[model samples]
Target: MNNEILPHEEVINDTLNHFSGKFENIFHQDNYDHYRSAIHDTLDLVGTFLHRNDKPFSGIEAKTMKKMVQHIDLNQKLSSYEEVLKEVDEIYVQHATAFHLPQYVAHLNCPIVIPALAGEILVSAINSSQDTYDQSAGGTFMERKLIDWTAERLGYTTESDGVFTAGGSQSNLMGLVMMRDVFSQKNLNHNIKQDGLPPEASRFRIFISDKAHFSNSKNASIMGLGEKSIVKVPTDNEFRMDITMLQKYMKREILLGNIPIGIIATAGTTDFGNVDPLEDIANIAAQHNIWMHVDAAYGCALLLSAKYRHLLNGIEKADSVTIDYHKSFFQPISSSAFIVKNKRELRILKHHADYLNPAEMDEEEIPAQINKSIIQSTRRFDALKLWFTLRMMGQEQLAEYTDRIIDLTKDVAEMITENQEFELLTHTDLSVLVFRYLRSDIEDLNALNLHVKMKLFYSGEILVASTKVDGQFYLKFTFLNPITTTEDVHQILNTIKKHGEDFGTTN
Candidate 1:
């Protein structure tokens, strides 16, 4: 055969050469220097941004930001990394909410530690998928070790097992799924994994505190159990689930022919940060033969606390539990886990695939995380963040941070209570303070508090969260940053007072 280099062939060869140059951007041995340079440049840019950010927010109006974002042309590729970074700085970094700032007491976001940041870099570059042992190798074992450590801290026995998830919502969903399936199998003699929800599924009820995270209701809906499946037990004056009301509700549900399948005890509520009586709740669950799942997404940090670990005294009795490292352990976003006391319960979510985790592999004793995870097949190696955090900071230092935030929250609560201008709704069991600016002269307190929150956001001096209680609006401060002091909180409260006064005079 004769080979001739035609014009079209030459064009194809040139195009291939051009594409080969792009391969240098890939994170491989051939482009190690390029990868290192890119990472260093990005880190430097981030460091500069963090160092210069003085406020939690930029005070840029939504319309202005939307317009700026619209101006970007994604179709046109940037010529250099510097140009791309400049665009990113202008559109995102400059306007991004600085969660690391002491003034940012708005939400559950925590200021992450340096060790976790380093782990994040390795996670992204290595890009290990924690679905199977073959895919992640040592990463799979590391994740298992972290899970085992967390389980031990939670006071679980050797039978306990868990897998890391994206966030609290996902972890909570896993708990609910386990509860639903286990109850169905035991009670109705039906396998939810093989055959869908049983005929008695509608009658299956899950009890939760009225102040519990909304994810429980959402998860119920996703499971084909309507929102009605969740029965909200009234909370006591301290915003904790009242055992009396819970028992009353359980009895009422049974009388009405509803099967109480599960009870979700909130270890730390979103608004008040108060933990339910876990020991009491666990007792109730045992009496009713209901699966007990502890939603400890916010309060799991107490497991490591030297001073406040006793607060979660009965968590060991929970059948399942949710933990969010991102919120309380100071890890970055999307690091959480759903742990089960009995490793056998995970089989409810197990599935076999010929190309992936076949049934025979189980007999061969191969470890595959996907066997326990229902929502995600290919998962990131997020467990590394917690591993690095524990390895570098150690449990004692991390526990100190938790203790510091809890103490800071108490100080802020006292400060709010002392001020006549604000009403401290309830004391917290964790680090969230729920209160509102008050004025006897102002007839509409809700409207006034709403105005203060909006004004603060627009001013960009401080950031705080707002939530409504019993039709009345209230301001919230979620103290997650250990570095945030009482003085910072005092200043934020004063800013709220100033805004409330400004609104009072004008309107």
Candidate 2:
């Protein structure tokens, strides 16, 4: 050693050797008494540091990260395990999203309940994939049963099946792919999954609401149906899709000899939380004999709410529906389900390679789940969180959680309405409110509101998301945390008012 400059491999090897060993070979406490104090202090310090928020609202911005990591490696020869743990923890864990905090009411999916988090740990430990029975035996069985349970909730027949996906975007993509497989009958007759896209892929057109999620257009583009192929149906004042307009457009397109592929009805839109009149839309879909899909990612959790379940009326008639556990069901992110009214729609994505999910003539149980699913393989058993949450809290508790956030949204709407400086975006349909900061005689404050949002984000006191509606910037609060109270809304309003006054005076 040249007076002690350590190589990279030597250091890494030393660290690994200290951390792992054979269980029986490592249990000699008397031999390791010298290292005992280090472990206790390290564990205690880690737990203690977790309680501290590196920045306000418990979210770590870049500035906060740089401030936390002020020192550079000029050359400290040897550091204790506790010191190294502290440094690594500060760098890595400090910049995490603060879902546990009461103020985190920003995006579609934020916090998850503790039960689901516990399930996350358990599922991670087991690490099951949803590809086959042997790959995730218990997970596979549970997911199938979960599908049946979800089907029952949706009022579908016993033949219905669903799978948990990464998120709403993937679920919607899968739905569109299924429709692609279905409408191309010549390809279906010849078996497309084994074959490929039919030659007539260019003619297929997807009809979606004007207020559909961006993911719809994205999915269309991904599935080889160009974004231009999605015909936008005008929405009514309530933001619900105009079924009459949709029918009119379909008729015009049909007369023009356009191939109608599938109809997508949004159950909950991003802007105003508007759900299309599914009952009316369903009738139009049935009359036209088009495949109907419902993107109910944010609003499908209404199924759990006794009072609000009526909002999703006729959802059962949909050919497929996308439900996000991460958004409304209060599970962690990457929890969503694409449920098909008919189980046969799932067969479109099945692929069989030799070592993967090979098919045999005499094989019982159909030989493969790969055939009846959209995803390729190696799915993180994410549905276990839903299953665990359901079993632990039950539907009633979940409903209560949803109801609490809804009540909070109501409080925010009321506060925004009474405030002279603030304008209410829309009435609270679900647990989301879109509002803007404007005094009397507001013309166009889109750019101003955009700046205000950026300023607020940089300040890191209160958290809210900015959305553009009708070409105007509006601040939105999507309350997912049950613990978020009326007081929290009051805090956000106070901040907005203060910012408005300061901004006006400065301007």
Candidate 3:
């Protein structure tokens, strides 16, 4: 039977009959118990896996994974739901990266809060689309309220408005799109939205810090501005954008007859976690009448922080801002927003459809969210997670959690600086630390540190990330878990040092 292959039509008919009852059952009060039981069973399986070990990763290899996947054939039917569930546990849960584990300090991933997780379940079960008012109902109002709440928290004026986005990259794209449309219409007297871009579009440029995220360049390309339109401004020794250099570059571009469209100041860079001087940069932008957009995707959580909120003093002055709750607010992935100081400017993205949001409406009719968002239709209820979290835990609680992670980062930085074998590259700007393992016996220090990272990853005990600075490799620790302790970081450093020492001896 294992070797005998059935015909496609026969298999399809058999498959349809196998789970006919499951699909036919409606999700009503009569079947509520059945739904509850299924949910518990699924969650119990995942909960068991998460608590099974303290290791931050699974040591599954590619060849073994290939063999495991080969057995799950669509032509065959499982005997019971339990069998299919068991297969899912083996194939997915057994090999997933455990970001909640304390030893996993690779990227900006955070340990999610409980309220947010609960919100995720409710959001999925209800399946709300925030695209139009009639489709979303109260979900539309809830999302807008949260956006206004965030804008007020950032100290923006009452005229501010925003939309929830997929993440930081999407938010960045929206910000740049608005900047492009506004600049082209005001300066070149050309409407890029209707006439497309003129030939002078190639000469239109935006400035960004050298350490900024790659999203800026990708956004440029997406907006028809071309990647060459990005002007990379130099950074200071601390990795913050040098304001003086930015001024000089702006003056030089003006002399060359180049159009300066915008300046992107990063609050919390990806590698060094450095915050650019917002006040100084804002003044320069105001003088040149250029748009100022702040990419605070990783650092916007500071708004909740009482002690560290001063780090982003001039953010309110920005023409547009990007914020990602997933990075620092301890929410799950794809929770973010793009906000602007002038609510009227969002009209550029408006598209009235007869089937959805018609152009003409009765006096009593309310507008749909599709008019304001770059995403025209069918958006997720991602804002509910943040809303539920804020209501359940309160603002102070979230702020405390953010502060705890920041404090742990400082402790990790101090430990690295004190260790003779570890070389600390930059000081703690937020919750990121970049350093490398070095010893006199090592020939190429960069290669040794990179090998250390790989060895630890495959060992399945812990997981860390590496970055390149000035063409040299360095190990990085991005501490986003509030419960992660100094001891955990100490152990990770020890593991890295041991791996480095062993590799040096073998060579």
Candidate 4:
């Protein structure tokens, strides 16, 4: 100390203390009480909203947001935390839904369980970065094991690999990247990363079911293979992809000399929850030498339940797949995975950085998991929630939870079938059921259904979504809450019926 030289340990200790002090309020242990209470209250609210059990909105809150919110510019820092948080509190007061409420039944979004919430707290506190072994240490191994657990659920025998991502969109993007990797011949012969793809391999094409998530087509365009390059195959009456149409299109496209690079098939379509005929599509992909990627973000939850697992036959045959634990598994906002059968094919992401470890001539064994992930550095350890869900609940328990929603949705569908006021758009094979409010008095029934949906959302006693199916408007009931029941569905129906009967908008 007398020498007036700063010691390295002293500096590190001081720096750590400084950061702990500066970020004290940002993430505090004391906030857990407040945070946990918030989660509980919000979950209750969501439960009410989804099953159409909440009080109708009177536009008071919307007016509040409009009047109170100061236009926020991304570059500007908050003038005061309290000032901003007040607005936020109001926003939540208005927008937050009781998704866990037994009556909540609109969106595919699930009411998250407490165990997963606890995992979220633990993971966020640890802040483990999964970019490298050194970054996450044991967390990397934990995430990989979680991936293995999910792959097992899908019936993958031996060789399977995957990486957890932020959400389904990111997972879908990763799938496209993988297809690009293998098709482009990025690393088979030499260091293709060091040099770009050969000119001949640069041009690419992708295919997706017409009913597939827009993310599939958007991802294709974002990957430099323009949107027009993605061919949309037709689907038959059941809403599953028509294999014959796919074959016809592929043959014609091939005849014109367009290479079939990838095929993206959806397991559960967003509007109808229809599972595509995977076996037929799988056979066609194999025949055409195309990469098969299944976007099973919504229906992937069915794999755990034997009753619903048959809906996704030939899933194991998919070269790549995207699954969203958030959608049906009741995980928090972000938790998705993109997986492939061939472990070695993950080499596409491998590239040596100047700061990265150089391969030692003597070192024989290295784990492929390090370089397999689509993101290069700074990956979040999102697997903890899934791991907790699977290990704690077990697959059977999870399956039973999913089955509960399926049963409730079917009940709601049957009710719709019985009521003249409600017209069934299609029978639900999974959780989501599409229908419309069709009172016999209405001449233009489709327009009335659309009006019912808009009025329902504005009224807010229930929040139901709508979709255009086969050139007509249909209101959607995406039942994902396990605790929901027939009583809940009837409550929503009653609300809709009351609205349908009302002739005046002056409520």
Candidate 3, run of 10 with poorest lDDT: 18-27
Q: TM-score for model 3?
A: 0.93
What TM-score fits each model?
Answer: 0.95, 0.84, 0.93, 0.85
Q: State which candidate has the highest TM-score.
A: 1
- Model 3 over residues 35-59: C-alpha lDDT tens digits? 7877888888878777886797787
Cα misplacement distance, residue 386 of candidate 3 (Å): 0.9
Each prediction's whole-model lDDT (CA): 0.91, 0.76, 0.87, 0.75
> Which run of 10 residues does model 4 get worst, by summed lDDT?
361-370
Global local distance difference test of model 3: 0.87
Clashes of each: 0, 1, 0, 14
Instruction: Arrange candidates by TM-score, descending.
Output: 1, 3, 4, 2
lDDT string for model 2 (173-260, tens) is 9888877777775334645566666666666778888889888888888766788778899987677788789888888887877778
List clashing residue pairs in candidate 1.
none
What is the full ranking by lDDT, best candidate first?
1, 3, 2, 4
Encode model 1's per-residue lDDT on 1-507: one tens digit a residue.
767666988887886675469766766676778788887888888987989799989899999999999988899999888998988999899889999899999888999999998899889888999998888989988998999999999999999999999988898899999999999888889998888989899898999999999999999999899999999999999999999999999999999999999999999999999999999999999987879999999999999987999999999999999999999999988899999999998999988898889887863377898888878988999999889998998999999999999999888888888988999899998999889998888899999999999998987889999899999999999999999998888888888888998985765
**Candidate 1, superposed: residue stretches over 4 Å from native:** 1-20, 362-364
Looking at model 1, residue 471 earns an lDDT score of 97
